[model samples]
Target: MNLADTIAAVATPPGDGAVAMVRVSGRRARAIAAATFRPSAGKPLQPRRFTHGFVVDAATGTVVDEVVAAWLPAPRTYTREPTLEVTCHGGRAATAAVLQAILRAGARLAEPGEFTLRAFLNGRIDLAQAEAVRDAVSAPSADAVAMAVAQANGSLSRVIREVRDPLADLGARLEGSLDFADDGVPELDRGTARAVLEAAATRVDALLATAGPGRVRRHGLRVVLAGMTNAGKSTLFNALLGSDRAITSDEAGTTRDAIEEILPVGAAAIVLVDTAGWRPPGEMPVGEAERLSGARTDASIPLADVVVHVVDGTAPHHATAGRERIAALAPGGAMLEVWTRADLHRGLHAGNQVAPGDQFRVSAITGEGIQALRSSLHARAVAGSRGAGSDSGGELLTNARHVDALRRAREAIDRAMAVVAGAMPDDLLAADLRAAVAACSEVTGEMIGDDVLERVFRTFCIGK
Candidate 1:
């Protein structure tokens, strides 16, 4: 973790592949590479351009592996420090040998996220950008990747800094008024201060609105299928996923555990879960497995972002009770009613007893209404994102820490607005504005604490 030491690590993921890379960063990166690597053409290694080379054991001068090395000098590299990357033939022996040779040449193994921490320390990137690197690497869906890329490109940092700028300016003006009392500088009136603070609060509100959808898109929405035994939850799950992911059977209580799958609905991803059939504890003539299955189904309801309560269209009332139970346990506005076996319905409107407008009627057997249901799910997922009401295309705040920081900034601005409205002293308004600026700075890492930085970078994988 020492900032001054040269660090090296295998940048590519573990295991055999077409190629692998070893990354080295710090002041001694170039020197270590020069010691362990020899150019194929017997020419001196140049900066920024790749050179075909052989990685050699420093102690014995034995060629370890064939590699292509690139040396990048400080102030323009990723860490704003001297960096070297060696791409070698993919395999455990070759890559590991090359890395060992680099280590023997005076480079220490890098700690988790050390490269990115160095980038942040050297001012090549800020806190938000550092976080974005992790997000981009671990993104589970396309939407998540897009959001991460935007933040990595400084979208979030720019937004935070820009919002803080006006507040900082207001604080400077208030200080000027206080210091130049005898010079007759016009002091900021409560009305003007309130107006400025309110405008800033509105911007914060806009950013905060993206937190929910950002989280949903980042981690994906948990959509669980729950209903009475033999209600076709497994069938519906398989139908939605377009594969036989879950075991479907005609017998009741066949599904004994929750089967989870990642299903992309438009740009958003849904963590679709198929839970065991719901049954009253005493009503089921079952063993320990069935009891546990019921308990799991019950437990999954509350955690789901959207619970698709499936009921048999042939016996809609039988599922009504289960639907009500799930709705009670699920988060508000998170339940979607689905009536299965729509193909078997024979009565008016295909034996659809429930009101036609409120629920989605689907038939797993015939694939009827499946695509419509997917489209509806996709639309609902999109609505959960920040730009639901407009085409603003603003950056969504995906990080929980960033959202919390924005909330704090918004609260500070609110306090300043309230103080101004109360005709409080200009110094009090300035203090609140300063607090707001500090909160915003946390997002950009301007005034961040050591503990926060440690926690942020620790989540990153080693060799990042």
Candidate 2:
């Protein structure tokens, strides 16, 4: 919380990799680097230049780790402060050594998101953009990354300012009319006030409409695979993943639990769950194990964005049972009928009687219809993410905090509009507009409190 003290942290993720970096920010950042870093090239640390160095202990004069250190001076850095980044060999020991040297040189360890928080406080980026940085780091798919990048680039903030500036103007007009009555200033008429507030509301509604798709983009879809036992669900799951993640056997009740993994289909990431096969609790030969698996599969049905009902194409009886099970288990989720083992269907008719679409047949052994099934899943996932009225150029509200603030802002604006329409007093209408302005300010960090800021930045990882 103390901006005056220099803070240091490992910028790269903790683990072994090709490279790791330690970041330091504050007035003393460059000085701390100078004390701990001895340039291998025998030169002093230069601004905005990477210098090869060996991090040395200040007191013992012992070499710590070989590194490349850079000094970014104040007013041009991420925090708009003197910042130092030390690139060392990737591993916990190397990063720790550099960080410890920084601490010995008087830089304290940074908390989670402290770097980004400093950027926000220093006016380099607003709060919405700060959240976008977090979103980009955790984005599961390319579409999510795109939305996050747009927000980080100030798309959402631009939209907020577009709406908030007009309301601020409306408030200023009301205040000026009230304060400058003797100066012959014109009052803001009810008609003009209503128009301005209504326009702002329309813009807010436009942003709010994207919250659904934005949420879906931020958090990928959950797709569950459900069907009766020995329906070749595991084989199909393995085929989709292109790896033998699930254990496939000739046994009927081998998969007694849900195996979950992420399958990136085009721009959408699907959290695919391969649940245990369905069976009546009392009828299951394996008793409790099968019963528990069935329960888990049923529980996952409601949580899925898309529930795929997989049935053996060779067995016509499974079609009816699969349909009944999907309808009874997952009433609200989108359902897809996938008939497996098409290569072994030796019957006269090739298509399923219940669902006779080309999209319904899939043979795990022969790899038939697998690509089509994947495409269908991708299409459905895209539809779930792209809400009504969503366009490529339009900005999206990806952060929940922003959405909540915008909703509150819209509610306040609605109240202000109603107040203006009722021929209310100028000060009363101004009060509602002020409330709306405050709510809007929270989204952009203009009028947010410390508590909200703490909650927002806490979701970020250390070193941002």
Candidate 3:
């Protein structure tokens, strides 16, 4: 965790490519590379300059490989260290060769996420921005990338700090109201307290409201396929994913657990889940899988960025509008409706249109209307979290951990507001306010725990 020691790693991903990169940080980074590199143009790489060189093994002083070297001087680089980046031919052997050279030159091999970890360990960034570094790399979609870039550049951190500072100050003011009341110092007026509390509460509540959507944006959108038995949900799922990821059959409960595929969506990706269509609780001992599948679909429904209701329009009308499935799946929400096997019969397609929002007629058998359906699916995936809260124009909190903390803080604040408005003493109000401040502090790493830190960093990809 010490930031002083230099760290080095192959930053680019493994496998064949035009170029792979090895990144090094800390004071000795440049010096170590200088000894192992000889630029064709001149003396070892000039500061803030990139040059062509051949990596020479320090042990034997023999040229091992050709590389393009870039050196970024201290205080002018990521991690605020003397940084060196070497671009070598990309192959499994090339990456290993270059990385081994760097390690042999005295730079320590980096652990997963250690580069960004060092950036945080040093004063180059805060916890929020450090976390954003991973998001930028692991971006699932363009919208997620945009939000991550904003946070990495400090937009999100600024908002969180602005929110945190006032909450911390309010906690002190409440404590002061209790401590200085005995000293005859004028306590915080009821009007002033309410104004501050309400404003802070509103700011937090606004961020919390977007938490659900923001999470969906970062994590690929989840689109669940639901319909009655043998309704061709699996067929559409396979077609959309461009693979036979789901098991399709004429049997009623063939798809027991929900099957999922990661499909590349517009500017991002989405997980299309094909679930067992609702069937009466098992009578022929066949309903166990069906019941479990329905229960899981119901559980995942609330988290869905969109729900695609697929049905075999040719099948007999079981319930008008499939109300039970809609009620069980979406409840008080809206989802896309699609009629599969639209080419089966003319009369079948007639009663298929769900109307209102978006309804599509497609045939998994023939390549009919699939392109349009894909476009619709793309729109839903892209619109995500921002679809509902189009008006709020500030940075949003996307971390579920942060959201849970904020929700707890808001509850404590609400309790304090009630306490101040009624029978409780100012001292009691101070305790609640302190609890709220502690919860908010955890988000900013102000007064957090090591376990929480490990959990956050553990989610990051290796060599971040």
For model 1, the superposed segments whose C-alpha errors exceed 4 Å read 180-186, 247-259, 280-296, 313-315, 341-368, 389-393
Kindly report which residue stretches of model 2 are placed more than 4 angstroms away from their true locations once superposed.
180-184, 249-259, 280-296, 314-332, 346-358, 387-393
State the lDDT of candidate 2 residue by residue for 1-464, as single tens digits: 78788999999999998899999999888678778999987999888899998999988879999989888998998889889999999989888988998899899999899999999999999999999999999998999899888888898888788888999998998999999978999888888898999888888888898887777777777778888888888999999989999998868888998999888989887778898987533345478878787788888888888888887777666567666777777665577778788898853233343344434678877798899888878887788788576332377677788889889999999889888878878898888899889888899899988999999989999988
Please give each candidate's TM-score: 0.89, 0.89, 0.86
The clash tally of candidate 1 reads 0
lDDT of 1 by residue, 1-464 (tens): 68899999998898999999999999898788879989999997899899998999988999999999998988798888899999998898888998999999999999889999999998889999999999999886788889888889898888787788988988999989988978999887666777778778877888888777788878778788999888888999999999998888988889998989988876778888999997633466378999898888889988887788787778755765775687577636467778889889853222233345446888987898788878877776666654543322377878899989889999999889888888878888888888999999999898998999999988999889
Record all residue pairs in model 1 with backbone atoms less than 3 Å apart, i.e. clashing: none
On lDDT, who's better, 1 or 3? 1
**Local accuracy of candidate 3 as per-residue lDDT tens digits, 142-178:** 8788888988888766766666677678778767767
Off by over 4 Å in 3: 1-4, 174-184, 228-230, 242-259, 262-269, 276-303, 317-326, 347-358, 387-392
Each candidate: RMSD: 3.0, 3.1, 3.5
For candidate 2, the 10 contiguous residues with the lowest summed lDDT are: 347-356
Give me the displacement of residue 199 in model 1, in angstroms. 0.7
Tell me the number of clashing residue pairs for each predicted model: 0, 0, 1
lDDT value for candidate 3? 0.76
